[model samples]
Target chain A: MIKIDQLSKVFQTSNQSIQAVDHIDLQINKGEIFGMIGYSGAGKSTFIRLINRLEEPSAGSVLIDDQDITKLSKRDLRISRQEIGMIFQHFNLLWSRTVRENIAFPLEIAGLSKTERSERVDQLIQLVGLTGREDAYPAQLSGGQKQRVGIARALANNPKVLLCDEATSALDPETTDSILSLLVDINEKLGLTIILITHEMHVIQKICHNVAVMEDGRIVEQGSVLDVFSHPKQPVTKKFVEQVMGKPDNEVADDIFIQQVNSGKVLKLQFIGESTNQAFISQVAKKYDVELNILQGNIKQTQAGAYGSLYIQVTGTDEVVSQAIAYMDSTSIEVEVVAND
Target chain B: MTDLFPNVDWPDLMIATGETFYMTIVALIGALILGLLLGLLLYLTSPGGLWQNKYIHIITATFVNVFRAIPFAILIFLLFPVTIFLFGTFRGTTPAIPALIVGTAPFYGRLVEIALREIDKGVVEAAQAMGAKTSTIIFKVLLKESIPALVSGLTVTSIALVGYTAIAGMIGAGGLGDYAYFYGFTRRNFDIVFVCTVLIVIIVFIFQFIGDWMTKRLDKR
Candidate 1:
């Protein structure tokens, strides 16, 4: 487990001091994937660097597995760092070394024997799915392959905590998906605690179990992936949710409701978990004798469960539409009237 | 022209060539070791460097600049006393070495600094995150990544040294240049001057060829 208490970082310039990270507290459990989402310069990168002591905190303590790492000596910090692996956005690899040598570097620092280093490097190469490219240099590899080498190198010492600084932002969307799945695979196989910082909502939606949305050096909102996606509380979180949702709430043209319904209504229906799979729309229509038109629908599977949202227009007798709305309210699905005039 | 080239001193030419090789080799080894060390110091002491020290950076930079600003011909004259103190002579192949080194080391030091500075900052950060000690970062990351640049810098230094070595012959250092001055130009032996110029050019070309080949072989990027 990693515990960050009131962690803050300040950069002192010639003219003035800038607070890159304000007072923030966070707790990440072992074997869980946590993500921090923010725009550029939101200080998410600084927050993550503080965990490994890459950037010294201006205030507060970082306790990993009950040890306050902020107070460790320089020598002790080096040893502690071996347990915390980090990957970067641009894939900061040694351009001169081959992939195998790059992965073997940390092991060499640990003073492992030649045979042991080679054996461990071989294992990591296989683990990251770069078995045959061990002898190739980073320059020869594609962006995705370079990141795989970076992942392999970071995991060389079997670290417990993996920090990814926009790890997939450099790759294409298809490559991003492949890397995300690989991250999930490693998280499950090794039970490694992953803390990734990204600006992309799809990245958080794809693999993160929990997410903290940051704005201007502060976390605006944080919760489980499914909870946040289904019911975003803050405006910033809502904006991010809209990024993956593909359209804002106001963008739902009123014509769809006006033209399809005369003296009818438009309502948003939210489904989570097993509710998403059930034919609730047909059931509600048949039971209440209402004609339903789904204007837009989106369903996605999160780490916790399935979350789906649909915008619909219902046209029928007033009594039947009211009965259908009342029936939806009484069930597991959440329904809200968008425009009820 | 026929009268000027009545008899060429082949044996004397060979000895002068040998003496030139001797002086260049000795000076090059000394300059390489000292210059590389000074360059590394300059790099580490600069602002935001790994071991930044304002005083060290200012002092080293001033010293390198002051020495580098002096022309080689005048520098040889200026270091006459120091040369005699170190080697007990200031008028032979042995003494010319000190002059050559003094001229070449600081010039090459800047080259080394430039080569090291060109390395990506991200590469160093990655090494640090991996728990590499400072010494390890220098040896395994900085130096390793900049090998091609460093080798090319050495090539430039060596070619420059060839020119400086010729100039060292002014103070009775018996090399090809001295032979050209005393026997070729002063004695009006145009053939000797032509032959010495050809040899120097060939030597410079050899260094360049080897440097280019090694750089290409070492660079994986």
Candidate 2:
């Protein structure tokens, strides 16, 4: 478990001071994948670096398994850092070293024997699925392959907490999915507590069990992936949620067909967890005397469960449509009347 | 060839060629080691570097710049006392080495710093995050990553050292430069001067070829 208490980082410049990471507290449980999502300059990068003391906090403590890393002496901090591995967005592998040598780097720092380093490096190569490219330099590998080497190198020391600083932001969509799945595999196989910062809601929706939305050096909101996806409170959170949930409400309202709805009403329906699995749209249409047309809908799966939204046009008597909206409200689905005449 | 250059003493020319080779190789080795150390210090003490000490950076930078600014001929005369103190004389190929190394190391040191600076800062940060010590980062990350640049820098520095050696020879140090001066130019034996120039050019080319080959072989990037 990692507990960050009132962590703050203020970068002092010649002219002024900038608070890159404001006072924030977060608790991540063991064997859980926690993600922090924010736009650029939202302090997500500094926040992750603060966990491993890569960016020293101005005030507060980072307790990993009950040990305050910030308080450790330089030598002791290095010793502690061995168990808190980190990977970067640019895949900061040593270009001069081959994959095998790169994976053995941390072990070499930890003073492992030559034979022991090789044995552990081989296992790590297989774990990250870079089995055959052990002798290849980082330049010889593709972007995904380079990240796999980064991941393998990070996991070489068997760290209890793995910190990823925008680890997948540089890869393409296909490679992103592969890397995310590999992270999930590492989390399950090793039970390592993984904390990653990213701007992509798809990343959070896919693998993060819990997510914290950051804005201007503070976490605006945080919750289970499903809950956050279904009900976003802050405007910033809503924008990130819309990344995977489809167009925003204002954009949907501006749709030509939605504007042409003279008599019918446009409703935005949100489905959470098992409710997404139910045929709520079909049942709602049948239960009420209404013709439902799904204008735009997106369903995404999260580690907690699946949550999605649909923008539908329902044509029926106003009373019956209101009743249908009330019915959806009574279920796990949340409904909003986007347009009504 | 013998008929064409009747004034040329074969044994004397051979000895001069040997002295030139001796001076270039020994001074190159000294300059490489000393310059690498100085360069590492300069780099590590610069702003945003690993050590990042202002005073140390200024001191090292001042030392390097001062040495680099001095002309090789004047530098030999300036270091005459120190050369005699070390070598017990200032009139042979061995004494000339001190001036050659001092003149060339600072120049090479600047190149080393530039080469090190070209490395990705992210790679250094990555090494630090891995619990690597300062020494480990220097050897494994900084130096290892900049091998090709270092080798090329050495190649340029070695060529400069060759030129400095000839300058050192102009005063009292014995080498092809001294031979060309005494027997070729002063005695009007232009053939000896031409022969010396050819040998020096050949030495420079050899260094260039070896440096380029090693750099290409080491650089996987």
Candidate 3:
């Protein structure tokens, strides 16, 4: 478990001081994939680095497995860092070293014997699916393959925590999917506590059990994947959630829904998990005598479960439409009145 | 043929050529070691560097700049006293070693600094992230990554050293340049001067060819 308490980092320049990270506190349980999502320069990178002590914190402490990492002596810090492995977006593998050698680096640093180091490297190479490319240099590999080497190198020491710094930001869409899957596989097989920082909502939707949305050095919102996706309180979080759900222009959606129905109401219905499979919309329409026209819908299976968003135009007497919305709300679905006359 | 080249003393020319090679090789080895150490210091002390120190960086940088600005021809004459004090005599090829090193070490030091700077910052950060100590990062990451570029820099410094070794001839240092200046120019022996110039060009081409080949072999990027 990693617990960060009131952690902060401030950069003091000659002309001005920049608060790269405010006093933020967070806890990541063991064997869980926690994601921090934010735009560029939003302090997510600094927060992750603080956890590993890559960037010294200006305030607060990071406790890993009950040990105060911030207070560790220089010698102890070096030894403790062996347990925290990190991978980079650029796949910072040594261009001069082969895949086998790159994977053996941490082991060598830890003073492992030659035979043990080689054995560990072979296992990591197999684990990361780089068996045949063991002798290839980083330059010879594609972006995806390079990341695989990065993963293999990071895992060579069997670290308890793995920090991925925009690990897929440099890859193409197809390659990104493959790497994400690989991360998921590793998370399950080894139960490694993984903390990944990214700007893409899809990355969080795909693998993160919990996520934190950061804006301007502060966590604006954070919760489980289902909770945040189903109900985003912050605008930044809402924008990110909508991005993956194929956001429709609110004005256009309102105009189109209003044009279709001269009165009544237009509502957006959110269905998640088991509720998505249920015929909630049709049931509400039938029970309340409201005619429902579905304008747009998007549903995807997230790490939590099935999640969906639907825009519907409910046309009937105001009393009946209100009754229908109330009925929908009584069920597990979330109902919001977007447009009404 | 004998009449055309009457002033060409084969033994003296050969001896001068051998001394030139000895002085150039010894001085180059010393300069390379000093330059590499100073260069590493310069890089590690620069702002945002691994072991950044403002004061050390300024002092080292200023020293490198001052030395780099001095012309090799004048530098030899300026070092005459130090050379005599160190070697007990400032006249022969042996006394030229200090001047040759003083001239070329800073040149190579600057080249080393440039070569080290070319390494990606990400690579260094990755090493540090792995809990590598500063020394390990310097040798294993910084120096290892910049080998090809360093070799190319070494080649350039060496060629420059060859040029300086010739300039040492102005202070009674024996070499092809000394033979050319004293025998060929003073006695009007154009054949000797022409032969010495051709030998210097050949040596430089050889260094260039070897350096390029080594760099190509070492560079995987």
Candidate 4:
């Protein structure tokens, strides 16, 4: 578990000061995947670095498992840092060291003996799925393999919290998915609290249980991933939600069905969780004698459950359409009539 | 062979070669340790370094620059008092070592600093994020990462040190330079000077070969 309180960082230049991270407070639960999504210069990187004091905070405190990290002395901070593992976007591996030696580096810092380090490193290599390439240098491996070494090295000490600063930003899409899955696997197996900052919404949608949308160094919105996806409140949050959801209204409006519809209503249906699995459209059509025309729809899976939106044109007598709308509104599905001609 | 170089003394030339080896090897070891420490200090105290201190950086930079700028010939005469204070005399190979180290350590220090600076900043941050102590980062990360550059830099410094030892020999330290200057050049024994030049060239070649081999072997990147 991690609790950040009023964390701030201001970089002073020769003639001006840049506030990289403003006063921000956040709480991340244990064994949960918490994601911070923001564009570049949104202070997400600085925010993550402040958690480990890699970038010393200008103000505020970070509490990890109830221990105030900001107040610790230098010696104590090093000891505490062993319990907080961090991985970088560049996979900052020691090129001079082999995979085995790189993974054993943190164990060496933690004062583990040779045998203990070897045994732990072997297990970690297996956990991250980097088995046969133990003797290879970082340059000899692919981008994904390099990131695996970075993960194996970070997890060597069995830290309580894993901080990932754009951990997969440098990887291709396929590699990024693999690394994200590995992070999920690690979180599940170790019950480690994961705090990752990324600009990709897919990463949050794939593995994160909770999502926070940041703007101008402030967290403008935070909630369960499903809630944020289904009902995005802030403009930035909506933009990110649209990253996965597509531009819904524009796409549906461009459809020929919506353009040619004369009578009846073009309804936009929002489905969340269990509603996506039900036969609401069929049931409404069968009961009310209305022709159901599904123009376009997108269904996506989140950590919580399924979330989707559908655009459908209902054509029938006015009385029957009203009855069908009333019947659908009674169910869990949300019905919005976009056009009534 | 005897007719070709009647003035050349075989035994004395061998002894002179041995003396050159002794001075170069000892001075090199001394410079390696001292320069490494100085370079680490310069790097660690530099801006955005692990221990960023403008004052320590400026002072160390000044010291390195001052010693590095002084000509090696003048450096020997300038360090005459230090040589005498340390060795109780300034007229032999051992006394020549003090000046040799003092003159070359700063030059080697600048090279070491450059080698350290060539290391990726992200790697150092990775080590620090791993909870490594400053000592561990210096020894394990910074030193280990820059071995190739450090070795190559040392090769250049060692070659320069060989030349410095010859200059020292011209003063009072007994080596091939002394043999060449006293027994060959000054005494009109061109054969002795020519042979000494050949031996020094061989020594330089050996150093360069070893340095290149080690650098190639150690550098995985």
Candidate 5:
């Protein structure tokens, strides 16, 4: 486990000192996919960079597996740095070195022999699925392929922790999905604890088991991926969720429900885990003797369990409306009434 | 014109050609090593390279500019008493070599600094993130990565050295330029001048060719 405690970083420009990373306290568990989502200047990148001591923290401690890395000596720091592999936003591969040599760089620094470095490089090349491009330079590879090499190189030492600072932000969507999957594979196969930081919530929605939402150098909200996505608390967290699910137009949704259920009523329902099945929707409709209209419903299975939110318009007598509410209350689902248009 | 072109002294021509090669090679080795080290210090100590100490940067930069501002001809003539004191002889090829070293070191140092500064910061960051020590980042990263630019800088330095060697003829440095000035111009034999000029051209071409080959071979992108 990696524990980041009250870490802050201040960069001094010509005019004044600017705090890039505010006091942030976070814990990333072992073998977990953790995501830090924020805007460009929200300091997610700096937070990622701090873990590897690429940028030193101005105020707090970063304990990697209970050892405070901020106190390591220069020589010990180099050794500690090898344990925390980092993939960059621009895919900072050495242009002069071949893909194989680039991947073998850290191994060489670790004082591995030539034959051993080559063997490790070969294994990494195959792991990243770039078997034949070993002799090729970074310029010859596409954006996605270059990132794969970045991944292969970061994992050269089988690091216990991998810090990916906007690692997939430059790639296309299809490429992003594949790279995320490969990261998931690496996490599972090597048991490497991964911290993926990006502005895209879809990236978090896809792979992150736990997530922290950052804004203006501070983490405003953080929890399980499923909890945060399904029931986002903060405005920033909701905005991040909206980025993935599109803006849930409460006004438009109310208008559509009122137009459809003008004679009766409509209510928004949230179901998590066992209550998310079609049977629950049917059970309430059957008990109330009403026709159910699920205008918008989204379901996603997370590391925890299945979680989803649904918007429904039920048409029946007033007596049945209360019965439907009472029926939904029997299960672990939150039901709320939408106002008439 | 026929009388001026006669008595070309072929053996003297061979000896002068050998001397030119000796001076260029030796001076080039000394200047390149010193200049490269000085250039690296300039690069690292500048505003944002690795070490950004303004006081150190200003001091070294001022020192380089001071030596670099002096014209090679005047510099050779000016450093005469000191040169004679050190080497016990100011007129010979061995003593003239130090004059050339002093003349070209700072010139090439600035060139090397420019080449090193041109290296992309991304490449350096990549090496550092890979657990490379500072020494490794210098030798294995910056030097290896900046080879193409370094080669091009060296080409510029050697060509400039060729020009400086021509100026060295005034001090009787016994190179092709000296032969051209003494036997060709002073003795009024145009053939020696023409042959020496041709040989200098060929040498410049050789350096250019080698520089071009090195750039093409090392350029990764």
Candidate 6:
């Protein structure tokens, strides 16, 4: 478990001090994929680095599994460093060494014997699905292959906590999906707690159990994937969700719904969590004797469950319309009245 | 065929060749070691470098600039007293060691600085993220990864050292340059000067060739 308490980082430039990470506190549980999503320069990277002591926090303590690593000596810190592995967007593999040797670098530094180091290197090379490329150099490999080497190298010592610094940012979309799946596989098989930092919400929605949205060095919102996706409180979080789910324009949706429901009352519905079941949408319409016309609708599945948003027109009398919306509210679905056309 | 070269002694030519080889080899090794360490220091202590001492950088930079600006020939004459005191005479290859090392150390120091600067900063940050201490990052990552570039830089600087050795030879240090200056310049032995010039060219080409091969071999990344 990683706990950050009132952490802040201020870098003093020649002219003025810049607050890279403002006062923030967070707790990341063990064996879970925790994501920090934000735009560029939102202090997500700084927060992650603070957990690993890569960037010293100007204030507060970083407690990893009960040890306050912030105050440790440099020597002791190095020993602690062996436990937390990190991968980067650029891969950053040593160009001078072969993939095998690159993976074995940290193990060698930790004083593993040559035979032990080679065995560990081979194991990681297999784990990352680069078993045949161990002898190749970073220069000889493609971008995805190099990042695989980086992942393999980071896992050389079998760290419990893996920090991914925009690990998929440099890969193509197809490659990004493959890598994300690999990370998910590793997280499940080894129960390694992953702290993922990225600006892409799809990355979070795909694998993250919990996510935090950050802006200007502060976390604006955080919760389970379902909570943030179903009800985004912050504009930044809303924008991020729309980027992934492609929210239809409010004006267009309203006009189209008005046209469809010109004869009867209509309502906009938001289905979250367990309410994503088809039974709720279909059963409600059949029971009320109302024809359902979906104007704009989208459903996204997350770690928690499926969440959906839809504006549906229903040909029902005023009393039936009120009853239909009232019945839907008892479930996890939220029903709101659209203006009569 | 022997008329223009009748005064040439084959044994003396062989001895002069050996002298030039010794002078250039010894000075090149010393200069490389000195310059590489100095360069590492300059890199590690620059702004945002590992240690990050602006004062140390200024002082070191001033010393390097001072030495680098000095003409090698004039510096050799100026060091005559110390050369004599150190070697018991201001003549021969032994006296030339001080001048040669002094002249080449700063030159190679500056070269090593440039080579080290050319390395990507991302590599350094990656090492740091892994919890590598400063020393490990330098010797293990920076120096090891940059070996190919460093080797090439050394090759260029060492070839320049060969030229320095000739200047040392001009100052009574027995080598190809001494033979050329004495037997060819004073005695007007055009054949001896031509042979010495050819030897210098061949030695430089050989060093340059080895340097290039080593660089290529190590540049597999």
RMSD of each: 2.9, 3.0, 3.9, 2.8, 3.6, 3.1
lDDT of 3 by residue, A1-341 (tens): 99989999999999999999999989999999999999999999999988878899999999999999899988888888888999998999998999898888888888899999988988888888998998998999999999999998888778889999999999999999999999999999999999999999999999999999999999999999988987899999999998897664464564654566656677877777643664666677568888888877788777778788777888888787777788888877778887776
List runs of model 1 lying over 4 Å from the truth: A250-258, A261-267, A273-294, A312-331, A336-341, B1-7
Candidate 3 chain B: 10-residue stretch with minimal lDDT: B1-10
Model 2, span A62-162: residue lDDT tens? 99999999899989888888898899999988888999999999999999999999999999989999988999988899999999999999988999989
User: Pairs clashing in candidate 5?
Assistant: none
Each prediction's interface RMSD? 0.7, 0.8, 0.9, 0.6, 1.2, 1.4
lDDT of 1 by residue, A1-341 (tens): 98989999999999999898888889999999999999999999999888888899999999999999899998999898888899999999999999999999999888899999999998999999998898998999999999999999899999989999999999999989989999999999999999999999999988999999988888888988988887899988988888887665456545465455555788887777533654788888779888888777787777776776788888888889998999999987788887664
Could you tell me which 10 consecutive residues in candidate 1 chain B have the lowest summed lDDT?
B1-10
* Candidate 2: Cα lDDT at B53: 100
The candidate with the higher DockQ, 1 or 6, is 1
Distance (Å) between predicted and true CA of B145, model 3?
0.6
Evaluated at residue A108, the lDDT of candidate 3 is 81
Q: Rank the candidates by lDDT, best first.
A: 4, 2, 1, 3, 6, 5
DockQ by candidate, in order = 0.72, 0.73, 0.62, 0.78, 0.61, 0.59
Clashing residue pairs in candidate 1 are none
**lDDT tens string, model 1, B69-155?**
999999999999998899888878998998899898998889999999999988888888888899999999988999999899988
Q: Over the full model, what C-alpha lDDT does candidate 4 score relative to the true structure?
A: 0.92
Model 6 lDDT per residue over A141-215, tens place: 988888888888777778879999999999999999889999989999999999999999999988899999999
Cα distance off (Å), candidate 4, residue B134: 1.2
Alpha carbon lDDT of each predicted model: 0.88, 0.89, 0.87, 0.92, 0.84, 0.85
Model 4 chain A: worst 10 consecutive residues (lDDT sum) = A273-282
lDDT of 3 by residue, B1-221 (tens): 55777888988988988888888889989898989988998999999997799999999989888888999888887987898789988888888988888788888888889999999998888877777888888888989999999899899988887788778876679998899889988889898898889888988888899999999999999
Which parts of model 2 have CA positions greater than 4 angstroms off? A249-269, A275-295, A311-341
Write model 4 residue lDDT over A1-341, tens digit each, in one string: 78899999999999999999899999999999999999999999999999999999999989998999999999999999999999999999998999999999999999999999999999999999999999999989999999999999999999999999999999999999999999999998999999999999999998999999889988999999989988899998989988998885656666777778887799988778643654777778679889888877888877777788888889999989999998888877788988888
